[model samples]
Target chain A: MFSIASSELIQIFRNRLVLITSLIIPAAVSAFFVRQHETYADLGSLGYIAAIVLFTVAAFGLYATAVTTLASRRQNLFLKRLRSTAEGDAGILAGLLLPVVVLTVVQVTAILTALAVVAGAPANVALLVVAVLATVAMMIGLALATAGLTNSPEHAQVTTLPVTLGVIAMASWVGITGTENLAWLKRLLPGGAATELTMNAWNGGVAVTDSLLLLAPTLGWVVVAVALATRLFRWEPRR
Target chain B: MSTTPVIEVERLNLTYGDFHAVKDLSFEVRPGELYALLGTNGAGKTSTLEVVEGHRRPTSGTVRVFGHSPDDRRAVRPRMGVMLQESGFSPDLTVRESVGLIGRLTRRTDDVDRVLDVVDLTGRAGRKVSQLSGGEKRRLDFATAVYGTPELLFLDEPTTGLDIQSRDAVWATVDRLRENGATIVLTTHYLEEAQQRADRIGLMHQGTLHREGTVSELTHTLPGVIRFALATPVPPLPLHAVVDADGKVVVESFELQKDLHLLLGWAQDHAVELRDLAAGPTRLDDVFRAINS
Candidate 1:
């Protein structure tokens, strides 16, 4: 399993698209903050932006990565070939998810480090830790959820559009709108939980109250996504 | 013969929504035998092979690999290898990486170098899969299939898109596997492949097994082609079952010796010499066309 994971990580880095998405997107998003530093007054605001950037990288790195990889593998009959081997279904799935999970972790760490060194804002370790865990779970769930609907590798990008766009909208809009009426709707959204948790954490200590609220929906999405993916995920491309 | 068949499909039926892809299919492959499932496009050859490989479950009936159901039991997979019609390796992965990953899935570790050598891919093992040509990539796929030295191997259209040389190379590998006592289930549209490699051939048409027998047995059962051009345009004889517009007699039958003797007698009696006379056993291609039509 570790060997399979290592090989997968190697291949993911070798892929120009995956490489660009994992590294370039987060760097570009972080650069956007550096450019707009004068307008952001507080460390909390900067941390919020960092959280949004981290969330985006996680989505692309973990969720989008997983769905696209699985779709392409299915299209190429890689999943089918794996099924023929001694590797059980779990091992095969773990192998596919390994690269994305590792990339997500690396991207998140890079973003947090960039915030500390370049942006001159120290990270709240406890809040950052919780935020990172939530981001990982959310992205993995979103990926499995998206993979359930993707029938082919070619359709992977299009099928993932809904989640990608939804996360961006939720993360970007919650800060701008600040409308009380939208809180309930945004709370259920994937990135909304991370955004709120990051905002509370960046202010001081861990936001126990906000983190607790986000946990329910986060866990729910993860459970549902896993179930759907297991049921609907096909090993072979439909002819 | 061993008591346990390497592969057994009993009254298997599969349907894709409203369309019946395979119906009442049944066959058994013993250890050390090369079994060919010969069919045309959409003839359920792939569907049948998929079921045996546990990629798809039969809507009805049972598939057993070494007396274990492939759909229900995961234990049989380790002893089996498969070469799917379409490959699904990461384009960025080198041939060695792909083969090495497959090797890890087996109980016995296969020497990656030796497997690459068997497929004649040692030189290109470091090359990315995307950079390899069609034939080279196919060799890579074949290398992965046999990497584990699987006891039962399923090859679906294994030689498609391969150059003549590469095809022959794959055939040699198949021969080697058979010599090592591996049971192979192969599906191919290439009749000559089936004729050359199969210990027993099963003909499938319209989701049904139309015929099943050894290559020689099928040839014996199918009609032979007796073609001859006459010196003079003689009256059509009963032996001239099918006459071409150019006045050449085409006779199709199993009794080639008797037919040839009778044809000679008729020519002698009429003082007409037969030109371009040819008599031979029917090929698998001929048998396939005759049965399908």
Candidate 2:
């Protein structure tokens, strides 16, 4: 597992296009959102802006990375080759996804810290941590589920569009009109509860009951995403 | 030191929807022996190999490697190495890194340079996988398969992209590995490799094991061929033989030596000069051709 992970990191760094694009997308999204937040000129809206930015970073950046990497490995028969070794599916999955998750976490932390310095600290640090964990899990599950439908890395752009647009739209909608008066929508759609949780974490108005209420749907998305991924994931390229 | 077979497949079957790729195939690869599996295209050879490699599940029957199911990867994988027709390496990874990574994933320990040197690829270690020529990539595939001196190795068309010298070098390496008590399973278009090296072979055709045995056993199924031109028509030959359109006597004889001796004596008696005389036992190619025929 460690071998696969180390090799993957080296390969990622060597591919100048992937490395540059992965870095530029997150950094640019962070910069854009941070600059845009200045127009509101209010500290409370900082969390809402931060949530949307992180959602974009996680949804489009990390999700696309995982899906593309997994699909490419499958299509090229790299995964089939690895399956012949001592590398188990769990270990392989963790090895491939952990780096992406760690990098996202680091990038998110940096952005949040910068925002805190410019604005003020998050209202609820505990809630913020929960929201971050829930969102990352949800995104990774969604990525794997989406990857199952992707035939190759080349086809990833078209296949990934629906989920990418869906995540962005959900986060954008949540940002525009806070998660209120839409109970079923929050519980059902992919990124719905995740946005609500993050925004609530930022706004600092969550009671224990409210946190549980937000937690249920986020966990539900994670479960559904994982089940779909396992059911649909293909170790070989589509013929 | 035990003599149990390294691989055993019994009544194996694999189907892809309505298409049956392998059918009731059975073969055993004994310990420390080089076994070659050969077939025409769509002969179910690849399907059989993939089942043994645990890359695909059999539709029916069983495959065991090292006394455990090939799908029981934890036990069988550490001791086995496979060189697929395509290495499928990431374009950006360096050769050394790819080798090291596979070795690590298979949980094998080795001196990387030593393994690279085995394939004569130590100098190309720093090159990216994409930068390496096709032949070099093939060598990298071989290097990794033989990296830790795996107990059982599968080489599928292992020398396809190789030049003559590299092919010789690879065969030499395989020779060395066999000497080290490694069990080898080879698949190749080069029948001579099987003829010269395989301790035993399994020939497949159209999803069935067409023939399986020692080289001589397979070739003996067909008759040795003898061809010669006669300077002049002589008395009836002492053996059964037919003349071709060019007036060349062609004899397909199972008892080649005796018939040849009889023919030579008749030629001596008749003072008939035998021209363009050639005699040889059946080759693996002949056996393969017979299957196709």
Candidate 3:
């Protein structure tokens, strides 16, 4: 698994298009949000800015990148080649996704740290960590499910747009509108509950128990995404 | 050496929705022997190979590689090497890196540089797979499959895009591996390769095993041929012969030697030149052609 991960890391850096989309684009977008943190914070709050930035990196950097990578590999039969080895199916997937997952974590951590430094630290760092981890898990699951419907890296552009845009829109809605009017409806959506949890962690005063309960919906998305992935994901391209 | 089959398939069937890609096919590849599975287009050789390689599951029946299920990768894969019909390396990775990654995943260890040299790709080691030509990519695929020199190897059209020299090099490497008692399962369009190297062969047509036997056994079922262009028709003195559309005198003979001698004697006595005279036993190509007929 480590061998495959290391090879994937090498390939990620070597491919210019992938590097631009997966790393540079997400970093640039996150940097803009950080640079304009005061404006976004005033519109909602520092917590709102945090949720948007997290979703930006998660949607583009981790989620879309993962989908494109898997689609590209499957299109070229690389996944089939890998399976020809002694590695198990689970190990092959873990190896392929580990680099992207770890890279996204690092990018999110750095951007969030910068946000904390400039906008004052969150009220609860531990709760914020939980929110980030849960968000990453949910996005990764969705990426796998999305990859099944994608035929090539080119196809990923079309397939990924709905989820990427939906999650970011969800974060914006939950963060800006405060979920006050339709709280249950907002939380029931894929990213809505996670966005609210991020806001409570950063802005505080939401109660640890209440924040912890937000995890149920996010974890529920994870379960649903994984189930969908199992049915949808294909190792070899259609003949 | 043990005489137990290295690979076995029993009543194997594969279906893709409504299409029955492979019917009830059964064949076994014995140890230390080269077993070539030859077939016409869409003959289910690939589907059968994929099932044996564990890339796909059999719709019904069992396939065992080295006494274990082919899907048991931990047990079966480490002992086998597969060269797929198409090159599947990452385009962004260098040839060396591609081989190294796949080799490691196979849980087999060998010097990457040495393997590159075996396929004459040491000079192109640093080149990314995207930059290599078609034949070069094939050699790179071969390099990875032979990395650990596993006990069993699957060569799927291993020489399709290769030049003659590179093709010879690949066969040389396989020859050396066989010398060390490696079992091989091969599938190729080149019938002569199978005729020359296979200890036994399984011929598939329309998703069934059309024929299976030693080269001699398969070829003996068909008559040998003798052909010659006659400038002046004067062959009413010996064995029966027919003129083809090409205006060449053709004779299909089970007793090739006796018929050839009689034709030569007749030509000599008549003072007739048997232009382009050729006589040979039935080749694998003939056996293959016989299938459709």
Span of ten consecutive residues with least summed lDDT in model 2 chain A:
A39-48
- Runs in model 3 lying further than 4 Å from the true structure: B245-247
lDDT of 3 by residue, A177-211 (tens): 99889999899899999999999999999899999
**Native contacts recovered, in order, as a fraction for each?**
0.69, 0.68, 0.90
lDDT score, candidate 2, position A232: 90
| Cα lDDT of model 1 by residue, B189-231, tens digit | 8888889889999889889998899999998877787887765
Every model's Cα RMSD, please?
Answer: 3.0, 1.9, 1.2
Candidate that scores best on DockQ: 3
**Chain A only: TM-score of every candidate?**
0.88, 0.93, 0.99
> Which sections of candidate 2 miss by over 4 Å?
A40-44, B230-238
Residue B181: error of model 1 in Å? 1.0
Model 2 / residue A111 / CA error / Å: 0.6
- Please identify which of the two predictions, 2 or 3, would achieve the higher DockQ against the true structure: 3
Candidate 2 on A2-50: residue-level lDDT in tens?
A: 7788788887877776675566787788877776677643533666777
Worst 10 residues of 3 chain B by lDDT: B230-239
Could you give candidate 1's per-residue lDDT for residues A87-164 as a string of tens digits? Answer: 778777887787778777877777667666665654366766776787688778768767868987579779988888
- A212, model 1: CA deviation in Å? 2.4
| Candidate 2 lDDT tens digits, B107-194 | 8788888888888888999988888898998999898888788999999999897999999999998888888899999999999989
Cα lDDT computed for each candidate against the true fold? 0.78, 0.84, 0.94
